[model samples]
Target: MISFGKILFFPILFLLSLIYRILFFLDRSFKKKRTLPSSVTISVGNFSVGGTGKTPFTLHLSKLLHSNFPSIPILILSRGYGSSGTGTRRVSENSSASEVGDEPLLLKRNLPFAEVYVGSNRYNSYLQFRSESRIPNDQKVFTLLDDGFQHHALNRDLDLVLLDCTKLSKAEFVLPLGLLRESYSSISRANFLIASKFSEEWEDLLSKWVRKYKPSQTLKFKFSPEKLIPLSPGASEVSLKDLSGRSIFGFAGLGNPDSFYSSLKDQNPSQLKTKSYPDHYSYTKEDLTHISEKSSDQDYIICTEKDGVKITSLIEMDQNFSKWFYLRLETVLENESELVNSVRSFL
Candidate 1:
């Protein structure tokens, strides 16, 4: 039975929701339309609040675009949620996660050739790109908007939405109670739907959902991070052979820590100790101290590239903490030909 207080609260929530919808609709109607530059702006985002593999997908798209057109100028625009710097700032070798956000830092590190910028307003970042004349005008510039599905003012050329299988069934309820940031109907605006972490069975269900929603097109993509890339310069290139019979303390502060833990387990096939932190968590000295105290008995303490960046400043204070290493994960399109063909068709 509903409590008396909850009964009164439900009506207030309904009223607020009605007001929010009205404002949302009005905002959509009054929003300024900014035409995308001659450059193709492909936005990779999701309907859910978080943990749909958007960062990895954006990185994968950048790599694919770069490999196909080596000389083409590609720029990645991210909101840089936790970044300290304000306005449009280009990420560089010297940039830290605290300045450019952890995901943007990871992208810059992985795709050093591509230009990466972080700004709250994607349109402003695009304008900044256009204003820069140092880049050749003849070269085709492609902008990959990271987590920009909700930012309708920028007007993206392609809208690719990623959906995690784990949340597919539980996304019925709206935000706070559930993971969806917007109503399911909002997916109708997407040009393509990417059901990440897809299996054969999940693909079938995704197809059904796509048909029901009547999205422009539906494509199945799987998110498999490449075998751990060593973070340190000379980590001896560890492989399955080296991981055998070794005790490791795996830890990460990513959206999907469980996936990272599972990946490590697959490589070792042994019980591994793990510690998980909130997404994009900044590590304090106390946090490192805790990790060191808990992992004293382990052979090595491993973390994700996202977490690894935060530890850099920490290690400088104490040399004994240098032994902690990170595993870098790269996303690859399972079907290269299909992905390439799709982009080519769009171009």
Candidate 2:
């Protein structure tokens, strides 16, 4: 049945698209777009507004770059979404989510060896990082621009767009009414298209969609969920086998909580209750107390790596409550050789 919410969604989508177009026009016309030299920048972004596994993909790409080019230092550029900082801030080991946002903090934690900086303005961030004495001026550098599909100002050597295969199966529309940030046609801007979190059944459907939408792009990849890790520091990392038959109270503040919930069910295959908050929701001590009360009966609390980082920080307040764990996923490209070759050819 058509609900009132559904009835209003069409106009809302129209309005969202209108705003998007206006912004696009302003960006092209009024905004003084900045383009850095093409020698060192690569962008990993998504067309959709929510979680398309961009963080994991960005990490994966960073690892790939590090492995492929060991001599060159890799730098990550992020918008620092939900961060309190106004200008460019270099993410350090001690940086909190509130200071530099969750993803940037996560990146810094995961790849402590690399440099991670957050800034709304890509050009300024680049300049700041470049000016650092440690980062040699003459050495060739590679910068990974996170969530930069629409950040057209910064020139990039590679533009990798992530597509959530599950979302593609459903009805597609632009934001306010839908999850998509931009039109499907925007896929053309991508040098590489990564179809993420798809099952075998969805592969045929995704192939068709890619052919229709981005036929020129040949490099394609898959994102695979690898394993689960406990959120608390020094907690034992467990495989999916370890979680089997466990009662899990899954909680997350993610753009795609269902993905985390479903993945948990698959790994555990037992009684699993979930609580979802908005994407980038900062959980307080009170919030944890409430969740703890609700999940008292469950064997363990589980969350995504994104949520794990945030929630783990709050563990100091309630040391007794420590059931939360996170999933560790890796980007598994279908044609790794081709992807590497294409990127290398471009570089």
Candidate 3:
């Protein structure tokens, strides 16, 4: 999706990208950033449009902060892109995906101890949160700003930017022209560079690219299979052993569906087939019906946590709920100790 072609439209897109760049620089020069009092905000985002393990890394980083700074309350701010809501709303485990958006609700469910809020303007959301909550003098908030690389209005203490190794080379142009939201040169603004969905295949290329930019630090991480979580209520937790030698019909509405299928394949399934949708896609009844027909021969139907949240209601109504499962992925950060120590010195 990021590759360029030798076409006339390419030049036109490049020209428009230049205009976008000018506006970006102007915004950076003129914009005033506001910081929340008693908060150390760490932004986990990327310059590209597609998946680069941003959400998983954000979750991992929040847990890291919680482990190191137990007394601090974790505040996660997100600009809920797909939700129909207008104002900032606190996401809870019981909250519907339609209310707070899928990712925020998922984060809230995963980190019940953390406070997750979604709104278009994160600065205003933080202000609203502060007005409502009673903070102790000794406790400072550890905030995780999700997908906030382009959110220049909010001041952040640390910027953690993720780049997908698989799409790094292809993303040569910015949005409208290519998959990247901004040019890779923008990485210089990042405090920490994260290479997500990493493998040895891109090591030399990644190293050369990193050497070119000389980021403060670079972290490598990959997704690993956690467990098979059944969609049916009161159903016992399924095992990878159960998944082994079984046919899988996997589907995902993610920035990069290939990454999901690749990880799922590692479970050693007998046969693997997949369907991909656009990022943050909302599944409908018609979509589920189509999936059901395609996956009729499959022993199990698998989807990512993101897709699972949106598909639960539809599957719950079906009689074959037992075959529905979501693959929970755990972010495996390499050289984690070094990163932890670096952050500890700051927070």
- The model with the greatest TM-score is 3
Candidate 2 lDDT, 251-345, residue by residue in tens: 88888877778878887557888888999988898998898899888878877888777777778733765566778876676666665666677
Count residue pairs with overlapping backbones in model 2: 0
Question: What residue runs in model 3 are displaced by over 4 Å at the alpha carbon?
Answer: 1-6, 169-171
lDDT of 3 by residue, 1-347 (tens): 43436355778777888888889889987899888777788888997776777878878888887887787788999988788888889887877777678898888878977999999888888877776777764457877899988888888888889988887566366666766777778888988899998889899989988998788889898877888888777677777778789999999988888788987888899999988988888888789879989999999988988878877766654366678889888778898777778667656
Model 3, residue 329: what's the lDDT?
81
**lDDT agreement with native, every candidate:** 0.73, 0.77, 0.82
Task: Give the higher-lDDT candidate: 2 or 3.
Answer: 3
TM, every model? 0.86, 0.91, 0.94
User: For candidate 3, what is the TM-score?
Assistant: 0.94
Stronger candidate by TM-score (2 vs 3): 3
What value of lDDT does candidate 2 attain over all alpha carbons? Answer: 0.77
Q: Can you write out model 1's per-residue Cα lDDT over 1-347, one digit (the tens) per residue?
A: 34465456867755765666677678777899686666777888887766777777777788888889786778998988887889888888778788889888888888887888899877778768767746655455788888878776777778888877655554353443334567768888887777776767676667667777887666666655454555444445455445566777888887767766766776774457999898989888788889889888876678887787777766644347544777656454565566566666645
